[model samples]
Target: MPSRSGPSDAPRWCVLGRVPGGGVARGRVAAVEVDAAGERSAPIPIATAELPAFVAARERSAPRWVWSDTPSWYPRLLEAGVRIERCHDLRLCHAILSRSEAVPDRGPLLAAARWEAGPGAGEGEPAESALFEIETPEDAPGAVPHDLDAALEEFDRQRAALAACVDPGRLGLLVAAESAGALVAAEMAAAGVPWDAAEHDRLLSAALGPRPARGAKPVRLLELAEEVRAALGDPRASLDSPPKLLRALRSAGIDVESTSRWELAEHEHPAIRPLLRYKKLSRLLTAKGWAWIDEWVRDGRYHPVYVPGGVVTGRWASSGGGALQLPRQLRPALRADPGWVLVSADVAQLEPRVLAAMAADGAMAAAGSGRDLYSGLVEQGIVGTRQEAKIAVLGAMYGSTTGDSGRLVPRLRRSFPAAMRLVDTAAAAGEQGGVVSTWLGRSSPRPGDEWEELQARASLPGATSRDESRARRAAREFGRFTRNFVVQGTAAEWALAWLAELRLRLARLPSPTSAESIAPARASGPAFERQPHLVFFLHDEVMVHAPEGQAAAVAAAVRESAEAAGRLLFGSAPVDFPLELRIGERALKE
Candidate 1:
């Protein structure tokens, strides 16, 4: 998504690519200027050594830089203390347009398999031996083409698809937001979250006792294991082996089908308490233990590799550092630099609010206005308690049809029929193997051929009862997936827009003046070492690392961006998206 340029107000674009016949850092860069009228200027060549300066100069015109992949292009510019205001990431846009149900003509994009390459493997690393050798695909197999010609062709295909797509405005916004997210992901990794190694170690020791010798259990884990063994009267039982543990529990008269926490809690055996505690500690030790610290943290920062749009619903995933699973117990380890503070915030009941806007459900919108949504439900007498309201809302979205959720869900349906009807229709379409789309045009993948075959076979003459059961189960399972996809996917779009808007806001803030009292965090690199920058982002939450004097401004930007995102997507909807915010030296839950 580039910036608007012509009479129709389309985005003006500057396309960049690698020039062949050059070596590594010695390569020449090729660029083209394209107007909204489909006219392109001759390729301009710039020396690799001078590319950063050229880009910095061109940015004054505020053209969206069109490039092959953000990971391949933006990191080098950021490392050089240069930042672009907007970009049209052809690789990411191709992915969205190729699979989008809104696109009337996806044939060209779908056939271009080269553009379907996964995200750049060496995200922060330079394309070749140096940052300027952008066309070298020797390392990344099946990578998106980085040569000038291929990139230009791919951009043309993408723009054509966008022109012919239904509701071009919405899809264009999604593609733009996704591209911005790519830039955000790279910048966050470069800055990293401020980490306190000593604090992390202290927390680890307090929870699991001191770190044990290599290949050995921690002291607390050993004690719990022995206690569980003693309770079962089996000194040699293998607690680590699930089958053996199950047999041991049976011998002790516990007789559980699995060692899962829920099943274990059902039995009152003496071994249960110690065993549960042991499993929890063991998970922490395994996932974020001493080894994790050695690998993920460096120079007082924890750098996680964020894969934007990694999930089918457009949610981000981490390839390294277990970022999505950072436990709350270790949150205190997220300490800001000496002169900086962390501004953290997360949306409250984001999906429900998104659902209210998508359905234009006036009653549901009124229920959640300026208060806790679940509490609002109780005040409106839609449910008897906060807990029931939560269960019913989750049930409605997740297609839950049994137990308390099932029983309470009908109450929500009656009170908010518009919201319920939206999901119910999506679920029915999914059951019949049809496509469903988010509010911003991100569509759900259709069921696979195997599923279609199973349903077809079950409908044929002389089909067995078992066949029909399997078909029904498969349909209902897909129904559940679609029921939640629209809400969750649209919520993810809202988050991306929020991140993009806030990033722009943070950039516009005046850089803090140098003072004797202020200390620099050199680890965050040139682009952010002395300025406020985003450090962390989960699905609905964000943490900005900013100078101590700028913390309040950062907090305001966080809230304001969320409001802008809601309006950008839903357009004057009455639904509210409130945030729970915190500002301090450390990221701690309130």
Candidate 2:
């Protein structure tokens, strides 16, 4: 398989373009490629202002870039276009662009850009312009197949059409780079297929046939939401409450109250209004799709699709359906199979360890190794109370706006100057459109032009008042990045170590009793095993589908692996990355 651990080390994209200097206010830009069919092409890595801060924290020796010519179900955002920054090291850059995925459709058309020769035929300085000097496959060679230019031009259009086919069968090797919708890369030197644009268009139109006319308005969300008066049922009541659809989740061992807390913020976003407007979006793909969901539970073991690098910052996605989005109450859906148990654990305040290192916070580091850091914060007069300590520490580390963290942050700032400075600086960099890096090589990317403009103007001579307002604003902006980069990056390291250790343990186990087990469980159903078969990981969280016999062993391995990673990363995890965990079916504790 393709090492989809990450699409490209820098993040996959589909567009590359430039915003004119000092021009977030001005939107004029030149695009790298636009298919004859109207779709555009772009590079996968971010550029503009987003380049500096968003890079990931991988091993220092890992490659800087990886490309995907084949289609991927994974999410790779090339906002407007991802800028393919010329590798600062030419050899590396050359090797990367050489891939078919990086090949240009028309080899930089001079005619397309309105050409004008540079100052001199051989000026010492080459124009920054990316247009290439097309060398029409010439060399006093044999009378090659028909006009090479025409054949090549025809191929581009056809390639794009084939790409849009969306056939499940196109799931193979680096096939042809279909310009179908401008997302393909071709290797295996086969002659370009002959495809006339007009002909292909006709075929596509014919294949689609007459589309159905406009239909009824989409279903409403509230209509689909049949409210179950209480949370499933009261513990003391008889089986008195009639279980509503999907509400029976409480019976399956999920903690309904706790999971709801994780998604509380999801309801506040301005865009969520639309989802509320069109409620059916919450329902299945369609009513018929309901059967597909019913089967997941009936089978007894939930197999949430594991998507590698699913989040914008390189997290994975769940796909057989949105497994990550499941309500905490339905965790019982992920019950153990006959001879298995679930081994699940979550890292406590992962981003904080990263913050301590990034900020070089010795106090926080000391607490991380010596005790439960969050509790330590409460005991050490870091904040007024336990909850306040949690709020303040998280606010310091993550730059969040929720609860007392929002208020206590300013107070914590006085006590934790260095760490606070780091966050402030990162947020400043973010506002000023600069990159931020972790202990590892990953850096926060620059925001594109729009965000960049906001940062740039915030710095001009007339930008702010005597209060040092703009400067403060910019500092905090970048600080947001600085605050999270260290924690996020280090947490990632911990996860890698955890994953590696779990894999080793799993490999050592004897075959399960049931070979027919597609999804096996440990002893009984429901309780998660603490085993090493850690099959999945999300930022700061790990999920292990362990056989019942080895659940505890797996859990121990998960803890040890994390600590080991901390030791490897920073001499001793006690002072750098501290491992803390709790287990149960639901993802959160009430």
Candidate 3:
């Protein structure tokens, strides 16, 4: 490994990619340098085995690591006890810049067909057979290339694209924040969320009775099943099957078309209540029951593999353990250690805040200033009440033009015309098959070929009224998706910024003393044992497990990070991102 430190003023980047044939898990590292005179040097290749030491020595210089995908590379480095402070994830950034409206020159990126491939199988999965697998004939257009040469080429193209962006600074910030988010995702999975198996078991037992024997139902579930069967007047009816349940309901004159809970609740059937209860309990038993606990929870920690940039809108998706869809009933199992407290903080009205900022809607921003945004709307006479304000705002963003939401949206349009115009314009774009983008340049995917074909057929010389109507409905459906995509996607970017800043702040805090260490902290691994660290993150919420003595500090860091994220995204805009912070032994109930 090379050890000489470079001058502080120079910029350096290490690009890592898989080597052709190395049985010992070897790869290639290219050291790229840029001097103060704007002079660039050719990439110097180093053997893969020397990476850890080289990276460790370069840590002090803090050069950014540019790689094909963060997940593929970072986890291995982390296991080697190496941590990278900064990176430019070529795959993630390529997804953003290729379609970003801000990018003035996307031709090179758009033509890089191999750079558009979906992420590798998520963390912990088997590695793909080939690193730079050539795009197949059936592969999607613009699939990202995976080898060293392709990574370097894509990185160069992405940099050029950023340089050609309308707001290069903001777009650059977005890419950096996105890469930081990838690091956070990997670290969170590595540390795992502290979970209490016993508490989960107790909650399950209380809710659905003791775990049943091999093939039998639990006491409460069995009781509910019997009650449902009796009320339906069909002892032989299989409550477990949706088709059977629906048939039973109809035979009993329930007049419901489906066994869905909402439709069933609307009816006055004698069996509806118990059937709903039974379904809820059944869901709990199957999704997060004893089997789930035994498989996911280990050493008092629940590790979930997080896939960053997994969704088209740039939101993360979990591969396993239902990390993103953790049911509220099971939240109590998110227990902190004996000497630790969980700083669970979630922003209120995140999308609306992002919309206000992005649209530069001063009145809307003023309404949400330093208070509950919905209540602020109510106080400003934008709507009669907080509930109405919420409905209208959601309806506008979601492109609802009927029902209560639709009726209420016009009122919001009158009050917050700028904010309404922002989403309405996005909706219009989608309706016309045009692309839309988030505040930070994450572009919504282009309409599919089938969607394009539908519109084309509807516009033909002899198109039927039915064809036109179907096209119109499909366009409107897509419009609603685009309308929400901008706000939701931007909100996700803001969240990534928040997490990145908070992670850095938490790292700066003092590590817990040995005396303060607990089982959960120990199980969290070397990177996060003592210091305040983020353990769990949902869209707008994050729970940090911290030492009890540092709870106040962690709370402050959370708030500070929120503010920092707002500033990073919107500069000095008046829009506020206020978090509903709760520092407690466990996550608080809403």
Clashes of each: 3, 67, 13
Best by lDDT: 1
C-alpha TM-scores of all predictions: 0.95, 0.48, 0.92
lDDT by residue (tens digit), candidate 3, 1-590: 32335564646676655444445333445565554333456766656555666677877877788777776667666655677788888988887888898998788989987777675532245344344221111112344444667776787788889888777998888899889999998888877888989999999999989888877888999899899889988998898788987888899889988889899999887798989999999999988998899889888889888878888788988887899998998898999888898999999999999999999999889988999999998898878988898998888888888998989998888888899999999999999999998888888888899999999999998999999999999999899889999999999999999999998998887776777655454553755555788889899999999888889989999999999999999999999998899988877678
Q: Judged by TM-score relative to the true structure, which candidate is superior, 2 or 3?
A: 3
Model 1, residue pairs in steric clash = 3-11, 4-10, 5-10
Candidate 3 yields a Cα-based lDDT of 0.82
Q: What is the lDDT of residue 200 in candidate 2?
A: 26
**Per-residue lDDT of model 2, residues 1-590, tens digit only:** 33424543322222222233344332222222323343434523334233222322221222212221111100122221221211111111121122222234323322222112111112222123223321111111221111223223323433443343344122111121111111110100011111122322232233232222344222333222222213334233222223432244345334344223233224343222332333224332332123334433232333344433333232334444455565443343344444555567776666666666556677776656556667777776777667777778777767876566788888767766777887777665665566664443334455566555655566677776633565566556566765576456445544544554555455456555444233432223221122224434556666665555556666777777676656545554335444455454323434
Residue 304, model 2: lDDT of: 40
| Global Cα lDDT for candidate 1 | 0.87
Lowest lDDT sum, 10 consecutive residues, model 3, at: 132-141
Please give the lDDT score for candidate 2.
Answer: 0.40
Model 2: how large is the Cα RMSD against the reference? 19.9
